[model samples]
Target: MATPGGVEVIGTDPAEAQTVKLLSNLLWFGQVVAVTEAMLLGRATGIEPTRLQELLAARSGSSRLLERDYGTVLRGDYMGAFGIDRVVEQLATVREMAAELSVPFELSSLVARVHEDALATYGPVAGEMLAAKLLEERSGGALALERLHEE
Candidate 1:
């Protein structure tokens, strides 16, 4: 079957396939944190949040998730397509999997905590960008995007 982004076979076994799926989700979750932090930093340094978002999207630092979620983030829609609670659950699953493999996952553990904190603050409402919202809130409204006027 064809999809927007060509799909690659991960593994033959269902367990392995599921592992890959969880890993992919974990990567996206991490990217959300990174991109949001970068945007917040840009704001702190006096760059407009929207302009910084554009630069990041165009620059080498861009990721598929960042590009895909751009509009949603700008509009503050956040998890309009998914639940923050689900994100926390997935991160927890990935962390558990890593633990079972005896792998050291300090960074992943931190990423999981970011989402856990978001889930705690937002109560599992829709908006994958809740972590971003959390950061913006922490920054005292520094990362809030100016309203984009439609032409």
Candidate 2:
């Protein structure tokens, strides 16, 4: 990741480096929307979300995001590592970047909408995974551990 100048330089171009960071955040936001939706879908279909989450984690669908965060989700604790409002903002930037490049951005747009909904529902300060809470609420069940329900 070192630039041509020296090992201390992260990138040769500042704009390109910023774009890389933005795209990485955008991908993470997309993954959150997707993983949460899958959990909700499994719950709606009579499968325990925890079990389904385990299956996804163990199989080809596994992602670093899912592996690291899904357990926190099951515990009813959406990590406050990032805010829903920040997620929405990042997605919007990605959408604008895509439009400028004349690239098809349907998936990015959808992901943005999901984060927007979460932001609207939970406000700016809520954690990134509040989107999962929104989906769970819409499904009339939660993706929480049984002990979380007891508490």
Best by TM-score: 1
- Name every residue pair that clashes in candidate 2: none
Candidate 1, run of 10 with poorest lDDT: 142-151
- The local distance difference test score of each candidate is 0.79, 0.81
| TM-score list, all predictions | 0.86, 0.86
Name model 2 segments beyond 4 Å from true: 1-10, 147-151
36-126: candidate 1 lDDT, tens digit per residue: 8888788789887778887888989888866767556666667667899999999989888889999999998998898899999989788
Which 10 residues in a row give candidate 2 its minimum summed lDDT? 1-10
TM-score of candidate 1 on Cα atoms, chains taken together: 0.86
What lDDT tens digits, residue by residue, belong to model 2 across residues 1-151? Answer: 3557764444678777678778988888888889988888887788887789878989988998878777888888877878888888888888999999999999889888888998888889859787777777777667897743764
Task: Report the backbone clash tally of model 2.
Answer: 0
> How many collisions between residues are there in candidate 1?
3
